[model samples]
Every structure is written in C-alpha cells, then in structure tokens.
Target: MKQWKPAASALLAFSLLLAGCSSEQDAVSKPPATQNKQEKPSQPANAAAGSETSKEIPDAVKKPLKIAAIVQLSIGTFSSQYAQGLKEQVNEFGGDVQIYNADNDLSKMASYVENAVSQKVDGILLDHGRADALAPSVKKAVEAGIPVVAFDSDLNIPGVTVIDQDDYSLAWNSLRTLAQDLNGKGEIVYVWVGGFTPMERRNVIYEAFKKRYPNIKEVARFGNASQNTALDTQSQMEALLQKYPNKGDIDAVFAPWDEFAKGAARAIKQAGRDEIKVYGIDLSDEDLQLIQEKNSPWTATAATDPADVAKLQVRFLYQKVAGEETPQIYSVQPHLVQKSALPEQKVSMNDIGKYVEGWGKSDAAISAWMETLSKEQKK
Candidate 1:
C-alpha cells in the first residue's frame, strides 16, 4: 500500500493563520442517502503513459530533481507527516527536497516561493497562503519553467495546479454527523477563522448546514490560528466554558480544523464537560489518540491522510515536470472517522485504514510511470 498521513500542523492557520476569527452560505446541505465512493486523485487519462526508455525522460523529471515545499504553517504533527510523505515520494523518484515553513507568515511564505524560483528548483509545492501573497511568486515559478502545485491556497495562475482536501464536503460530513448525533437540534460553539480558501469553502457548507438544521443554534463562537494554535484554542475554549458554566450550555464544538478540535476537546475534558462533543475536519497521530481516549469530547472528524496527500501532490508535480496534461484543480477526498470505530489498543494512521474504510492511500493522480519509478527506486 502507498504510505500516507492532516490536522495541518490541524488548523492551517486551521484555514488562515488566526489573529481574530470568524462567515455564511446558502443551500440546505445534507449527506447523500447513499454515500458515493471517494473519487481517485485525477489527471488526464494519458498523463501516466510515458515512453519506456531512459532517454525518453526529461531533465525536469529526472532523478536528483531539486524541489521546494513552501508551507504557511508547520506547528503540528499533521505538517510533519505531510513533509514525511513528500520526502518519501520524492525519494522514490530520487530528488532533493527542501521544505520551508513560514510559521503562519504570509510574507515569509511568499519570499520562500520567490527564493525557490530564484534557485530554479524543478518544482514548488505550496500549502496554505493568500492568493494576493502567492500568485505573483507562483507565476514567477511557472514562468521560469518550475512547476508549482498548491494545497489549500488560491492561485489562479496558469500552469499551477491546486490540490485541496475538499474542505466543504469535509466540513459537511462532520457537521452532518454532529447534527445526526444531536438529532438535528443542539447548541454549538463555532471555532474557525477566515482568509483561507479551504476555510472559506468549508464555511460555505457550514452556512448551508445551519440553514438546513434551523433547530441547531450557535451559542458561542471563537477561534484563532497561531504558532500555539492548540494551546491558544484551548485557552479560548476554557474561557467559553466558563462563560457557559452549566452542563449542556454548549452541546458541541464545530471545529472544522483539527487544531481547534484538539483545543475544544481538551477544554471540555478539563472542564469536566464531557457531554460536549467536538466535530473536526482533519486528523493526525495526536488527533487519533485524543479521539480514542476515554470519554474524549472529540468524537468525530473528516479527513484524508496527509501523507497520502503529500505523495499525490508530489506525483502531480512530477507529472507536470514530465510534460503531461494535468488538471488545474484536484481534490483529495475525505472520510468520516467515528471514535467508536477505531481500535482502542493503539493504532497509527498507517494501520487505521482497516478500521476506517477509505482512510489510507488512494489512486488519485497515480500513473503507471510513477509506479514504475517507485519500483525502479526500490532497486
């Protein structure tokens, strides 16, 4: 099986790095009565069909390719696992990978992208930044013949591909689950931020969710994304708990980001408000542990493995390098994980697939040549 690992570092700013945070949307949203299969990572059908000879390969796709991964934040285990997958995939193809984390600074992230272009790296993989901050650098990289692939950022530049975890669907899945658990009526706390593409999309779904479940009310709302996201979130959640000291004052926390989930869960547990549930949108080793803990308030989350996401991003980058036709936008599918399904005996992300169907690696963006490259690398 392909090795795979979110909770991006869990808040990715948990959608924009949080300062003070806050959104609305339309259309009543509900889960499909019959769930559809997760879509595979996609590319042009022939994107994978490369000629067999070594001479057929391009220098850009060749081994020792120098690549840069510019990330907006790297505070959590989710980010570390993502980097691990990237290195793992790049290693299979034999390349030099440099990952730069901006510590939630958009300016630094932009600079890192510019630096990558100046260095003439073969490819750039970007995560979580604003369009205004990143578009110019992304265009620069493309103009220099360096392929740029982004995850959770808005870059409309031609020749750059954007990958996302379908945050709207992710949020809806978890929110829908929460609604179902509460029988469509409950008071919820919203932990969120803005200025992120993923977060915005999720917010769209959230707005729809509220419209659909008019009975559910948002009692308290608070969130921020920072270097100390979990800690800050925990502090905020604690404060909210104090404001609503009575049991059942907050029925649940809709933290579409894993970092927010972690914080809310901790706060609820610490306050001995085990009755409040947390519904989140990303997962990691730490997240899984929390969800599985005895009476963890964090009961459910929707996520795709970050490592698998990293590997697919690398594959798409390589595909672009090979002069293949690739899609402009690709979404990594997410799966709902209920704490009740996970084994209590300690399991890692790599092994949790058995417990959660569609939780591990995917064929998204995978090509025959890519598989061939992996086999070749093994030799």
Candidate 2:
C-alpha cells in the first residue's frame, strides 16, 4: 500500500471543524463483557448504534495517521479475516496500516517493531509477540512517543493496552461440552503447543480439565504451529491414529486452535474413526464447513468473530492515539457453538451472528465520533 502523509495545515483546519460539529444521534459505548463458561452468551450492547452521546473527533486523528500492524504469524481463515477487519476500521480514520508479518519468528517480529519505530509511525499494533523478544523494542517505540495496542501478547509495559479473547472460557466452553458428551470418562488426545500466550492460557484450563476428570485419560499429545499448520497437524494425527489403531482407543480430541481441529477432524474422517469427536477453540467459514460435513468428527467450538476482534484492536489503538483513557486490559467474550446450533445450509462470518448472538458484534472502545468518522468515510 502507498504511504499517505497529509499536510499539517489541512489537519489543523479540519480539527477545528470536527471540534465544533455536534451530533444528535447517539452511539453505544460499553465495557467488554464476559460470560460464564457454561452459560449461553448474552447479547452485547449494539456498539454500531445506541443512545449515548459521543465525543468529538480527536485532533490526533484529523490527519491520515500512519499505523503499523506487527504480527508473529498470519495463518488460517481467521487471520485473513482479522486483517480485513483491521484494514476496514483503519480506513474509517482515513489512515493506512502496514502489516509486518514475522511468519512465526519472534526475533523477526522484534526487528519489525524496531523498523516501525524508525519509520516513526503514528501507532503500533502487535499480535502474538512474546514479551522477552518484543518488550524491549516496544519500550523503544514507547520512548519515541508512539501509542501501542497489543492483542494476545505478553508485553506488560506501561501505557500499553492489551486485548484478547477470554482464552480460559474458550477452553472450558469446548472442554466442558466434550466432558459432558463423554460423561466425564473417555480417552482423549490432546493437541496443543506452548509459547503463544493464548495457547498457554488455554493449556491452563486443559490441565484443570485433566484433574477434574480423572477417568478421562490422555492417550497422546502432540502439536506444533507452522507454515502449513493444518496439513502438518493432519499428518501427525494420521500417525497417532495408527499408533492407537482401534475404535475405542481415542474417544475425543481436543484442539484449541481451529487449524489443529481441522487437521485432527480430517485425519479421523480419513481413518474412518467416526467414534472420535473433535472439540476446538476458534471458528471460521472453512471450519464451519468442516463441522457440517457428513458425520464430521469436529463438533463444538468457542470463538468470537475474527473480524470483530480486529475491529476492536483498531479502535483501541485510535483511543490511545486520541489521548483518551483506555483500559489496560480488555477481554472479548467467547461463545460456544455446537454443530447442532448451526443451520443446515452454509454460512460465512458475515452471517454467523444471525444464528449466534454476540458472535460478530462488540461495543468496547466505541465512541460517538467514531460513528461519524465511519459515515464520513462512506460519504
């Protein structure tokens, strides 16, 4: 994408117009909500529209702000959707976001942050970067006076707002349903890897599940996130099925990431292991299609819309840039989706919320001026 740098004089004149403009239309603004792992998700307040008055557009956003989106990995449908949402939201601000994809290399991700700092971008958005590798660079960026917002990162620096899905619930929502389906007694293969913050948090819940259900034994455990995560997972799972080599040897497979779930579900289907059920976290159009396959082993999943997640990240970043107070941490609630809850026909993220409440909507970090900004973009 071409870089956009608007003149300072134009921004000054626009900011005055924004500060004087008033809107009678109200916008909804609410803190991010959390739901009990076992309960159905309640409707989130409509952040796209509502009854609360909104503040004027900040002077910081009057110009075409330059944003840098640094990511550790960008794989799967969710990743693509998230990027699309982020771009659309940033577009509303008449800004551009340059994505620096590290392709799963933490060290490379660090250098991208340093590069962004060198560019003196208006703001930085981080995704899935380790604190040890990324924190120092983040400090340098903060020292340079750039606002930062992180999603599913371990960076604990001051003046940084962190955002993530409720990983604990994402795990328990699927795990609990699996335990109930198996009556708390069955052989389960655990598909997981450590290092990523979301994976690590979800693993904590997995450990609790092992202790909670003593009878539900673990037969095999193996996973790795790579360039071809889904295909690699499928090959590994195929080998695992061979090792077990019996109908009852593996009763259920718990894959917290959709890629792993898709891999495991595909392997099970190929092996004719119809008895095994795959429970996973995160959902996408491809994943939903897999779940709806004839006698597909993949069943329940817990997730928020990947697009909505990106939308929130962009809003939070703008909030910081606008010099508004922002929560140090924000958690977007995850919802449980069972195969039985989906309609018989196909659907995509654009329509998932029609069947699942709160799947594709959020009100966190929304302000009245944002609605006006969005309309301005369309006009």
Local accuracy by lDDT, each model: 0.77, 0.79
User: How many Å off is the CA of 258 in candidate 1?
Assistant: 0.8
For 1-379, candidate 2 gives per-residue lDDT tens digits of 0000111222233233333211100000112234112111142222221213555677887778899999999999989988988998999778999988999999999999999999999999998888989999999999999999999876667777777776766777899899999998999999999989889877866776787789999989999989899999999999999999988899999999999999999999999999999999998889999998988999899888888889888988887787766655556778888888888888776777788766657766776677777777677
lDDT of 1 by residue, 247-320 (tens): 87889899988888998899899888988999999889999999888889988999889998898888888988
Q: What number of clashing residue pairs does each candidate have, in the order they appear?
A: 12, 0
Best by lDDT: 2
The true-structure Cα RMSD of candidate 1 reads 7.5
Summing lDDT over every window of 10 consecutive residues in candidate 1, give the lowest-scoring window: 22-31
Off by over 4 Å in 1: 1-59
